[model samples]
Target chain A: MIPVSVTRDDVAHVARLARLAMSEQELDQMHGYFEAILEHFAKLAAVDTEGVEPTSHPLARANVTREDCVTEPMDRTKLLANAPLADGECFLVPQIMEDE
Target chain B: MNDMADDIGLLNRPAHELAALIRSGEISAVAVTEASLARIEALNPTVKAFLTVTPDLALEAAKATDDALARGEELGPLAGVPIAIKDNLCVDGVLCTCASKILDGYRAVYDATVVERVKAVGMPIVGKTNLDEFAMGSSTENSAFFVTHNPWDLSKVPGGSSGGSAAAVAARMAPLALGSDTGGSIRQPASFCGITGLKTTYGRVSRYGLVGYGSSLDQVGALAADCVDAALLTAVIAGQDPRDTTSADVPVPDYVGELTGDVTGLRVGIVRELMGEGIDPEVRESVLTVARALEGMGASTGEASIPHIDYALPVYYLIGPAEASSNLARFDGMRYGHRTKERAADHIEMYSRTRAEGFGPEVKRRIMTGTYALSAGYYDAYYLKAQKVRTLLRLDVEAALGQFDVLLSPTTPLTAFGIGELVNDPIAMYMADICTFAANLAGVPGLSVPCGFTKAGLPIGAQFTGRAFEEGTILRVGDAYQRATSHHTSLPGLLGAGG
Candidate 1:
């Protein structure tokens, strides 16, 4: 039996939030994977993690201060060469905002 | 070499030795480069290790190495040795796809720090090799381009996402290659290919241009045929870079020089958790054999515990994907790479469609998982909780390392599996990484050395992870092991039988 923490629809919702479009079939597949993996992740709930701090970076420094000086930037022409759509200097997007 | 003229067998020799030959003008760098290109052309068709073959770049770099020699300039240790960069790293004017269709048409405008260092040291940039899309899988099967077969047995996978680099070195396509390890990507592949790979301490190498995966977990390191070559290549890339603030300001040690061929009194710990269940009997024996080998060299071996390591798979799955979903978010259609042709009513549709068309299944699966975990309402339950447990994992590893200089285990629970074996079962595939990922979580250095071969003859690897920033100790022990053992000396028959 698959543990149903998330339904197929919920996967689609998350995919949407992730800015990824998925077909009904891909969502179904992702749903199955989520159940299996999240079921394994459920084991973490049993650990007594009380008073334990969250570790964001393994080699975290108290602070990282870089010199606030100008640095060389990538060539605009070269960067644009990598883009799928470029108009003069700016990247050409499909459209700005859909009519509300 | 003056000893042997015309560069006959230079293709398979160690990078350091090849550089020495080039330095002495015994073998002209051009001759060595041509030899390397010939071997790669002959073997790459079957091994499929390289995604791009930049013969022109290789020759150009070799010419520079020769010019340096002609001018009597002192060259770096790896000078004139050809190298394969994993496709994920940015190499200027070269393709940087990360093996994803989403990034298919992209070429880097600048070089990754590691790529820059490789150039600085005078090694030829042979080409970019394949990887799992977005560096996301245990096997190279996830590469959008194609799978890289294990050099040992053509039917099996070269463990990924550094599989191509490992195969290239293993096949003698190149003497050195660089791979990134987010979770055993470098070590597992090197182990499967019967070569040496090192994952430097988290901040040990600059991450300025590695296409971000698990930002905190990822590190760029070396893949080579042995410890000396691995250390030489690693030394060239390891150091602080102001561009990557996470890169520590620690002094880079003479990794190659530190391999003194002695490990007397070195403390080795056999991680009891890593050696137990879920690990194959043969692989367990192989790891124990490695410990015994160390013992024979006068290094003390004892059982060490890091019980929380049991949860590492779950923790990594949560954290890696969570970070990946964020890291991969930049691939929207506007900037670079594949853009959807289908009509879209809005820009969001364009982004959604672009990604849907761009990402491979494994990549999408991870992105969805990450998005779900990091999404509102589940952040604390999933992402935050995993981070806190990561703290427990760090403390456990810290305690274990405090007692031992290096902790040892099987790099993978088993040797290479057949191509189609675990592709359908994600959980089974994730389980293979359990032995190697904890070091990434702890930001410690991990090295995988070829220990033995399986009954079926696939290479077996034993992992040695050391205290953070203690890469020298692990490399010294690995070099000593290689000096004492013959497992790393065997090459694939394909190299010999290839046309």
Candidate 2:
């Protein structure tokens, strides 16, 4: 597969997918950054990786479970301390749902 | 003081020796803490090594150790030895920004498991060090705070994302500092700053409280003035943590005691691919010098190849950013950290604006690249293929290590470059890590030692990659090498105080 020549639209689409707001200048700058990075990835495209396993993690372990028991949770006050907008014990964020 | 450790005052002394001085009552822990704090106070403005200095915490721990010693109680091994913590690790109520604006005004609510362990041992806490924003770049220039200057030359960068920690130790502001490695973050800076740095095997240390970067590749380790100091710190922080299931149940070795300084009868492999082409001629010669010295110590040397290691840079860029995109997804203007104040119409708008405002250019670039690679129609072409190639790299490394006790290479292609030299050409900056990234990709332990310096007076480093969970072996080579050579003894003539 040939490396896709990422356009400003592609950069804009990716940034939006990443939930990052960017000015036109930033998007233009990122277009160059992505072009260089993708060009580097072209070698990986040529390499034959058939029958190879993907390593999601270095260690080969999973399902780390413990006996269900009551335990103290992180202090609500402390957890809320860095919240940009906090309401008593909860984090206040922009409304997610609209009234029907 | 011992002969090798002579000339330099209390601050230049290694942490283990300082602990011995305190234990013998020849000096009080408070004096040691004061010396370290004084050094930081005098030089940190110029070096920009530390983002926060905890004098109160340092003195409090010192006093406690002094009280214990006065009562005729046995002193802890690292008692009153001041250490700097990388800001990415939580330190409970202390600032824990990964030198990113995203985490500005944020303080940790609990100690990272590593910090808790350090405090439990009663070592004085000096401060939090700076790094690349979210550990994203090759230089501390990405830090929202300030760039950490290499002690050797003020104009050069201390390589990141552990630049601040490496700078602190090189300037002798702290004898020990903890840092995390994902890619060449720890070793590359250690080489540039001329300190002994050890990047442990992925499962050798806990990551419970470290800020997530490339989760699979990240390992907490140390930067120090010498091999003994490196061994002392790595030993204290390493062990299986139930909280981090990925941490291995392997028994932590007695790193200091096991440093018998004997590389005799062991085979050392000079990794051909890591030394040729892109590597500087002087840096390659410095690595060859280490191989020669080891040969003189009765160890035999030979050429070795990992075959697939040449592809590590592209593979690392792919995998690290992909994982980073997922690991860092939590920074979405919600639970904690910086949130935008601009009036917003909806949730996505708030998150987008907040990240755009908070993240640095490097961070934004990475998040975007990762999103693109993992998005529809491109996953197989990029992310998945990179992962599969990672397996090839790992197997090749395993095969090589199976043939030799350790593999040697230059830590970076060259010594420290001027501050803005490669910062503009991102790919060029990534090339600096050519010799070191494969260790992270392999999840193996690697140690960088001061090999030699260039005619320009900048330091060069030789790295030894050990088999998984075998930090003691590479450390043994580093310890033996330091005992024979005085390169590790040299420090920057910056502070206008030491030596």
Candidate 3:
């Protein structure tokens, strides 16, 4: 069994970190789901993994770099076509600061 | 339309055969496009596979192919073939929603590498098919839109997040389709829908335009009616892309030409852990039957142990969610995609509210789980531990592959279950991926081929996983099996009634 228990507060804190807003009902539901998922993951502790290197990629390869050559860029009109709010060539978002 | 369906029955022919017929002038590309469009129109309401259909674009591409053929220009193997694309792959000017509300009105400005290649080869993209929101679930029930039904039985799930692609192929709505497998998205659905699906080795196919779920585990692949068609599609799409750094700079082999149908000297291993408890008896019997058939063809089969196989699901859930948490951070409602209409005091409020409104319950759960796992105090115990266990699983698979040419197992623990049976239980839903995720964790190539049907008439899939960059080996074995058996020829009952 998972040694750590997930409470409603814990779920809410994690959601805040993830930048997701959850209601009271959803938070309660997430608490139970989190506990169950942790219990499933508890089995991993049984394996003896000493001095094993973690694999981040399937095959071993180094970071690839290319010569800094300029290429034609995508048209700005096309780029802004999907933008929810666009002002001229710039993206519009909610005001960042409040008037003091 | 009936006459057109009768004359060519474009839906029933293999993709390669259709290409040949189109090239020979026996059938016009326009007629084939019309027939496929008609089929989609008639069946899409019932199957709910396609999220967007593009008849005008398809006809335009078909006209170009016909014009090129008339001029005697040599075209690629997939010329004039109609195919469906999974919604997650970007197609320029098309609404490329990853089946998530967050990307509600987003349209792609550029084509995904695979999409560019297929279009270059003259494949008419008929539509974008439905998928689980962000390709996060094992069933299409997680889709923000309608669920894609299993053509074999409407009440059962078609398997997902590639469910729409597999369902389209099974229902003969399209001859070929593209799917991305982060874990078992492609293979499980292929098995459930009774079609052929291949998950290419990680970095084998470019992930340039694929919406990231698990960046390290995701690979774009093909779903088709049979092994040769799958191989043909793979040959067209597999190779290095300069834009995607992780794409291996390896030579693209003649995948289709390599089907020697000879597994005589091949040694096969049945993963002992995969067939044990929790697997449905019928699914296990079908997989064993495939092993016996392989042995009958002069191939040797033996039991091999990958002791760490049991940990694949847990390891995958951890790694997949961690990567997803980071990759999905781009959709903050600042520049594109969905934005909150409610008044926000500041940008932070906008981001949080947009995401809360945009993501579904399953997506939110994964994001929270990953955030907790990667949190400051818990990283070592959860994330790091899972990574270390992942290494052990990879090594175990490598050791087994060292002994055998390929490993075999059931693609899923059971046949397709009812749509909502496991939806409410997250762990139970995850168990459906037990037999398939080891290949992803190891970054190896895996293929799901139709083996037989359960007594209730649901399809059973037998999986063949080969070493990294050795997709040819498994494809050869899968082709040999298809040649020997008639299972792949059987269609869903609805297809018999002119659907």
Candidate 4:
């Protein structure tokens, strides 16, 4: 069963974890949506998965490894072309270190 | 020659037939390409199937194919055929938006493996088609840009997240298109648009350079005018690729060559759970009709119960979003895609604002759902439980397939819904994928073929699902059904009236 009713606080907390900035209105909306979706998912609680092993990848292939060799990478200019802000060679972003 | 070209009905011909015409020197590839472009110009305004139309790229590729043919070079199987790709698949130098603002201004630096394969076979890609944002949601209404309309009726949606690809083929904008199926994205849309769509086994087709949404569940496949064209395109794109480790090492079958249309003595199982209750009467009737047709072809049919079938929707919702949250993490403000214009105090603010601004409501909701599911305290209750249920679903399918050559069901519970009808209700929209999602969860091949039309003139599709690596069998069944029925050949009234 869905143990907890999704609150605005829960939406806010999850939104933060997902790096999303939600307004109060959006948070309330998300909370309702989450509650409904989670309630729908609550049906799975009835299935007795006593000794069932989880299947992540549908086709069970093991250790898809490749040769440890270096190959030519994509052109740096082309790779960086889509960057929102780039400083010629690297992506430009807001300050990483806060004032201490 | 020009008059002959004009009368060729270029848009309605199958991809293989178009290629054959080009090869035989009856019509130039340039003429065919121009004809398709003209159709796109005429119909795309109403259909909204394309996110980006690359006329120059299409014409250039078509000319090259003609040049190769003129030089007496042996052409590939799909040579000179016009195709469209769902916007999520990367095509080098073309805008590859997943119908989300997050990917605005982002052009892929390289082609997806499927794109490379299609290009290698000389298929001229006319454009990138629209889809739901990051391939989330069941209808193209989730598209950040615009919703694609069903060709059969302009007021209704072409089902999604491969809506545009399906609509493109259905409207005769293109003969073949590629769509990725993660929880029935391809088949559902094909069903809605009255075309053929194949969702290959998980490892059957390479997913390299496909923008990830539910990584484990995703398989790139074809949406074509008919099952024969679908099989031909599948053969060109299905072999193992070193770039994608999940692509199976199994030898690729000549899917076109396997279309002997012989399903005599094939054991067909109709999943009782999928047909009862919630399914619309017309949709259910179409499925039954297809079953009867199969029985007439000397195939035996029986009711098969997959006890866990009802649980598939909840399982898919949990698992699909969980993977999507992880896969979509790359689209922060710094590297690529949309970045917020507002000044931010620090990097975190920029990241938050960028994501908030870039992603659509459905995409954001999915990310939140996934984050919540994978959160520390709830992991076992939701994500893990969903995975375990997935195992049960797979086992249930396996047990059913053990007794039957293929399982059959309606592709969608209903015909194409009117746009905006279910857009506000996410649960109602999610329910549309019920019949198709189980195949994805079980890692099997499923084909959607046009079965019949609703009295309202909307298309209904029946799904044929085969066990793992049994695409040939399913295609054979689909082919035989098409041979027996005229539903696949019937064009939407919109196409005839508009043209």
Candidate 5:
């Protein structure tokens, strides 16, 4: 079992980190679900990887170097034209709170 | 009127016939475009296959093909044929939703490499097809927008992430459609919908501009009415693109030519593990027929055991979700996607509110599962063990290929289950991928061809596996079998009947 207790406040905290806004109903529903998820992951904590090296990719990793070259980019006017809302030459966004 | 019905029908005709028609002036490129759009309008609603339609642009492209033909301009194969692109692929001026609400309104500024190559060969884009939200589920039921039903049985789901593309091709809404296969997204749905689908080698087709799922496993492939059409479309789009770092720089051989090569003297392996367990009897019989047909063509067939397949489903669950958790981090609502608003709250609240509202339950479940798997103290047990399992599974395929040129199995355990049968339980849903998951873990190519129909007339697909970069071999055998049999040619009656 997951040793950590996931309180409603904890749910709200992780939600904030994940950028999810949960209603009280959702938070209550997820409380037990999150606990179950944590327990499921707790199964992984039992494996021994003391000396195993971590691999990020299955294929060979190398710098994908490209020549310093110049080429025509797609027309910016055409590209940004589809943005639902835009400012002068850039996408527009609603203001976020300073703390946010 | 241009009176190019003869010419255009050539566009919609079987690839070989279309090739002959193109050579004979019986049809022009423009006629095919009109017929495809007319079909799309009539079928898309009942099937919910397309997320966006581009008729005006498609006609313009068709006219260009006609003008070029008049000038005696040499057209490449697939000229003037209309093809639908899955919504996951970036099409300039079209919304590349990946069937997720997060990017619902986001239009691509440029075409994906595959899109660019296909257009260069004179294939008009009919539209963007629907898919699971971020290519997540087996059933298109997880799509944020809507579900794409099986053309064979409307109440059932088209196996998905690429369901809409498969359904479009199956319904004859479009002769061919492009789909991205991350897990069994293409093949499983192709099985369910009664169409031919191919998951090319990981680097065989460029992934540039494909919204990343499991970046290591995803591939762009074709869903078509038959293997010949699949081969034609695959040939045009299969090539290395400089923009995709993982793309292989190998030369694309003439897949069409390979189709005509003798299948005699080939060693075909039927993976014994995928059979004899949970496989519907009808689906198993269909797989057996393909084996018998291959043996008749002078190919040797026998059972090969892949012991590690038992571990494949679990490994994929771990790796797929782990990668998904990381990749989906980019959709934080600030990057031109669905963003939630809050009043007088901190930055954390802003993020929590946005993601909770934007993501569907399936997406959230995966994200949470992945986050836990990657969290401190849990990493070694869950993530590390799964990686080792993935390695073992890959080695199984490597050893099997040492003995056989290709491996065979039923594409899915059963034909299309009812729409709601497996939706409620996530683990049950994940288990449906038991047979097909091994290929993704092994990073190899797999193709699903319509082997036969169940007594109820639903299609069963036989999957053929090849070593990396050997899709030509699979297509060759599939095309040969299709030539000797009428299974792939048998279209679902209603889909082919006029809308």
Candidate 6:
């Protein structure tokens, strides 16, 4: 069950930590949303996974073998044809110039 | 013969028959492509399913297929079929935004391995479809740009983050679509939208061009109106690729040839943990119906417990978000994606403003949760603990699989809910993956097929999961169940329904 009292401040804290700039209205709306979410997550607290060791990956299988042979390269012209901003044989970028 | 014309008119015709028509010169590839496009145009707007529709490209590809056939060139299986790709898949020169604002303008320079294979076999891509932002939520409402509604009912959600893929196939917008399942993205959506979806073993199919979410759990799968079509698409795309490091070295089995629907002497386990508590009664009945159907088909069915199954959702929340945070780190509004312009600011300021403006709310939530879980003080307590627990969860399935060929469960606890119902409650949204997440955690194969519909006409799906690399078992079970019933054959009453 999610908590009913989750505040806009809690959502703001989370947004700041996430490096997001949310408006006050969005924060107010998100508080009620987060509260419901926390309640739903609270159900997991009742679940007992205490002694069970947590697994990161499901596969016990490993050691996929592969040949080290080099393959032909994809045509560079074709590869870079779709770049939105490009220079001659290179991708262009905004310059970070100093104004001393 | 005009019989070819009538045959091509049927939207749900089996793949093999459609292939025969194309090969025998009775139906041109262009005809099938046009039929699919016309169907999409007729229904897609109401459904809000497709993000992009590539009519020109599809027609051009179809013309190329017709030219090839005219020259006596051999077309591979599923030749000339039009299929849609989930926006998350990289299609060179096409937008592959994963349905997010951050990647609004980003296009891939290369095709994903699966996309390349399908194209090589002469399948034309219809377009990219909608999904949750970075394939995160259980409903497509989380999509940054649009909400894809269930074709069966407009007010209800089509499950996510592959909702558009499932809905597209359900709406007959495409004969088939490829989807990636991370904690039930493919199967849940399939169940909700009433189609056949398969989540192959983690490495069974190459993940070369799929934008990463949970790398270990995500496997590219297929959505089709029927099992045979699903098998047909799976055969073409399932194979080893040097580009994706995790792609299996195993030989690609003749999946099409092996669709015999014969499962005599095979052991099927009904996971007891999944049936009780919170699951809708209708979903449980549907699972039991399929189990009984399989049992009658000479497969022995019994109840088995994967005790740690309930912990899957919790473990997934930790692991999926952690991986997502890291994977999405590349989208700093630097290379390509929606970037906010900052005046009188340094590089860091530009980066911060761009990211803040680009990512949606759910994406931000996951990134924060992931960052906290992997942060200095909490890494040992949360992230490491979750990884260890994942191994234990996998062992639970291993223990059960020791006695059974496959496990059975309701693909989702309920059918499609109202769109905003779970979105406001993120935990509830996460809970939607409870039944399907275990297979992702264990990196095994899972398939969801429409078993029955609820009293209100919503679809209920039954999932069959198998041991790693034993996709044969899962497919066989699904084939057997589908053969025994007309559930998978039934289509949404498209009379006034949205696609």
Q: Against the unseen true structure, what C-alpha lDDT does each candidate score?
A: 0.89, 0.89, 0.90, 0.91, 0.79, 0.81
Q: What are the per-model DockQ values?
A: 0.64, 0.75, 0.71, 0.79, 0.33, 0.33
What C-alpha lDDT, on a 0 to 100 scale, does residue B362 get in candidate 2? Answer: 88
TM-score of each: 0.97, 0.97, 0.98, 0.98, 0.91, 0.91
Q: lDDT tens digits, residues B1-499, model 3?
A: 6664473356788888888889889987887888888888878999999999989889999999999999999877889999999999999999998999999778988999999999998899999999999999888989997899999999999999899999999988889999999899999999999999999999999999999999889999999998899999998889999999999999989998879999997999999999989999999999999999999999999998899988998899889998888888888988789998988887777788999999998898888888888998878888888889989999999999999999999999999999889899878998889988999999999999999999999999999999999999999999999999988888888776543
Candidate 4 structure quality by residue, lDDT tens digits, B291-321: 9999998999998878998899889999999
Question: Which tens-of-lDDT digit does each residue in B392-412 have in candidate 1?
Answer: 999999999999999998999
Ranking by lDDT: 4, 3, 2, 1, 6, 5
Give one digit per residue, the lDDT tens place, for model 4 in A30-66.
Answer: 9999889877789999999999999988988898898
Give the TM-score ranking, best first.
3, 4, 2, 1, 5, 6
Output the lDDT of residue B326, model 1.
93
Among residues 3 or more apart in sequence or in different chains, the pairs in candidate 4 whose N, CA or C atoms overlap within 3 Å are: none
As a whole number from 0 to 100, the lDDT of residue B36 in candidate 6 is 78
Error of 3 at A85 (Å): 1.2
TM-score of chain B of 1: 0.98
lDDT computed for candidate 5: 0.79
Score candidate 3 by lDDT. 0.90
Candidate 1 local lDDT, A1-100, one digit each (tens): 2123887788878988988888778778888988888788898888888899999998767678867898788789988887788986998876656668
CA RMSD (A), model 1: 2.4
- Model 2 docking category: medium
The number of the candidate with the highest DockQ is: 4
* CAPRI rating of model 1: medium
Candidate 2 lDDT over residue span B262-346, tens digit each: 9899899999998789889999988999999999999999998999887898999998998888887899879888889897888
Q: What TM-score does structure 3 among the candidates reach?
A: 0.98
Q: Over 4 Å off in model 6, which ranges?
A: A1-19, A22-54, A60-98, B1-8, B495-499
Residue B192 in candidate 4 has what lDDT? 96
